[model samples]
Target: MMATADEGVILVVEDDGAVRNLVATALDVHGYRHREAASATAALLDLTSSTDINLVILDLGLPDRDGVEVIEALRGWSRMPVIVLSARQEDADKVAALDAGADDYLTKPFSVEELLARVRVALRRLAYDSPATPTEAAIYRNGELLIDFGAGVATRGGEELHLTPIEYKLLALLARNTGKVLTHNYILKEVWGEAVASDLPSLRVFMATLRKKIEPDPANPRYLQTHVGIGYRMLRVEEAARL
Candidate 1:
C-alpha cells in the first residue's frame, strides 16, 4: 500500500461488508491509510486505541449500536473528523447525525468524486491549522469579520460591535481555535469556567446572539459553523489562506 506520513488515517465504520470494502478501496486509492470496523463497538475501540486515526466514516445502522451513539460517544472525548455515510435520506436523519456530532453527512449512492472532495475538505481542516501560539498574531480576520485578541474586540465590516463579556469570550475561543470543532463542554469550561461547564442552554443562547452580530445572515452563518451535536468551528485558515 502506498502511504505518506501526511495522508492521515481514516476509520471506516459500517455494518455491511460490501460498503466497508468499497470505502476502504476508495481510501486506498486516495492514498489514505484506513481501518475497517464492522460495528460501533469496534469503531470506538479503534478510536480509543489508535492515536493516529484522524477521521471516521460512519454508518448510521450498526449491528450493535446506532451510529449516532458512536458519534455522541466519540465527541465525549475526541473531535476527530466524522463524516457519516448512511442510506437514511431524510432531512431529520441528516440533522440527527450532524447534531449528534458528525462533521459531515453523505447519503447512500454517493459519487466517489464527491466523497473524495468531502474527505479532502475535512482532512484539510484537521491538517492546515495548529492552535495559536503566544507569539502568533493577535488579530484574526475573515473578510468582514475580525477578531483582535490583543484589544479583545470583534468587529464586522470595519465597525466595532458590542458584545457581552461571555459573548466576547466565546468569540475569542472560536477565533483562537479556528477550523477545529469545540465541543459544548469544552467551550463552556473555557468561557464560563468549569463551575458552569454543563450549562448548554446558556451557551446556545450566547452563540445565537453572537451570530446575529457578526454574521451577515444570522439565519445562515458564514463565520461560525455549528457541528450540530458536537459544537462549533470558526472558518479554517486554509479556506481563506489566499486572503
Candidate 2:
C-alpha cells in the first residue's frame, strides 16, 4: 500500500523541465505536496507568495540568477531546509552552495534512493529543530567537555568554552548522535547543509578549530576520532575516555 503521509509541502526549483517532472513525480508518489519553479526569480516569487513551504529542492544552474544568492536571501528570513540539486561536481561549487545556506546537496545523476534519503534526513532535522519538538538533555557529557543544549552553553573543566555557532552546532550534532560515525555528507547536511557537503577541506578546517577548543590535545583527539576516508566518529563513554 502507498502509505499516505502529510510530510509537508516542498518547492522544486530547477531549470530542467524533465528533472523537475521527475522530482515532482517522486514527491507525489511519496505523498508530499510540491510546487515547481523554472528559475530563481520564480522560486523567490513562489516563496514569497506561499507561506507553507517546508522545504526547497533547488538547482544551482538557474537561468535568471545564481542559486547561491537565492539561498542567502532565503536565509535572511527563513529557516526552511534547502537541498541543492545541481550538476556541478566541483568541490568549490559545492562549498559555495553549502556556505550559502543549502541544507543538502546532490550531484546530478543521483539515484532516486539517495535523493529520497536526503529529503527524509532534511525533513527529520527540520522537525527536530522545531520548537514543537520536545527535548530532554540539559547537559551532555563526553569526557571533559560538557554541552548544555538547553541553555546553549558548553564548558570544559568547569570553565565555559567560547564556541562559534558552527562549532557549537557541530559539537551538538555529534554529541546527540554519540557512538555513531557520521559521514562527511551527513555532517555537512546536518551542520552546514548539503551544498557544502563536498567541501571536505572546509569541514576539516572547522573540525580542526573545534578540536583545539575541546580536545585536551588537538594533535591527538580523545573525543573526536576521524574515520579516515569515511567520516568521523564520536566514541561512546567507555571508548572515548581512553586518554
Candidate 3:
C-alpha cells in the first residue's frame, strides 16, 4: 500500500524443499525473479538490510522463530506484503498469520496454477506501487464508497463504514479495482491466506455478510455487486453516492 513493485524485491522464505522448489519453480516459470531464505532469521536479516524486498512469501513453520514472528518483526520497520506458505491446518493459524501481518497464505500440496494465481494477486495488490499509476490499477470509485489510497480507508457518503479485518481487506481488493473480475481462489488466497482455499462455501457466506454491511440494498446490492460465475466488483460509488 505504501510503495509499488518497482520500489524493491520479492522475497520468498520457505524451509520445505518440496514446497521451496515448487514455489520457486512456479515463480521462475512466471518470469519472476526473487530472493529466497531457508529460515526466519536470514529472512529478517535480508528484509532489514536490503532495501529491495518489495514482497515476501513466508513459511510459519520455521527452524528458528515462529513464521508469524518474522512478519511481526518486518512489520515493525516496513509494510512490505507478506504471504504465508504453511502446512498448518487450523483456522486460528490462518487468522493469526493475517493478523500478524501476512497479506495472504497458501497451504501445502497446492497446485502450481493456484500458486501462480496467488502470486499475481499479491503482486496485483501492489499495482498502485508500480513505477506509474497504470490504468489497470487506477483510482476507482462507485457511489458513496470513497477509497483514499493514501489513507488505506474507505467511506460512504461522508460517513465511515467500520469494517472487520477481513471485510476491509475484501473491499480493498474488490473495490479498489472496480471493473476487474477477481475469482474466489484469488480472494481466498488474498484474504484467508492459502490454507482455506477448499472452503468455497465459507467464502460465499463471507461475501454475503460483506455485502450486507457495504451494500445499500443487500438483496439487490448496488456496490458490492456479484459477477455470477466470477467474483465481485464494487459498482462505481458515483452511481450510488449522494452528490
By TM-score, the best candidate is: 2
Residue 138 of model 1, lDDT score: 78
Q: Where in model 3 is the C-alpha error above 4 Å?
A: 1-8, 130-150, 154-169, 172-243
Over 1-243, each residue of candidate 3 has an lDDT whose tens digit, in order, gives: 132336356688988877787777777666676888999889888888887667788889999999999978877877667777788857678767766666666677666676665666566656544454433334446666676655556677778765434556788888756767788888877765575566575466557656766777787667776778777766665553432
**What TM-score would you give candidate 3 relative to the actual structure?**
0.62
Q: CA lDDT of each candidate?
A: 0.76, 0.78, 0.70
Residue-level lDDT tens digits of model 1 in 1-243: 344677678899998998888888888886888889999889899999888899899999999999999999988888777888899977668656655666666779876766776677567656534564576447888777888765667788899976644566678888888889999999977754454556575467567767877888777677888888999999853463432
Candidate 3 Cα deviation (angstroms), residue 149: 4.6
Between the candidate structures 1 and 2, which one is better when assessed by lDDT? 2
Q: What is the TM-score of each candidate against the true structure?
A: 0.58, 0.68, 0.62
* Candidate 1 vs 3: which has more TM-score: 3
User: Of the candidates numbered 1 and 3, which has the greater lDDT value?
Assistant: 1
In candidate 1, which residue pairs get closer than 3 Å at backbone N, Cα or C atoms, i.e. clash?
99-229
lDDT of 2: 0.78
The per-candidate count of clashes, in order, stands at 1, 6, 15
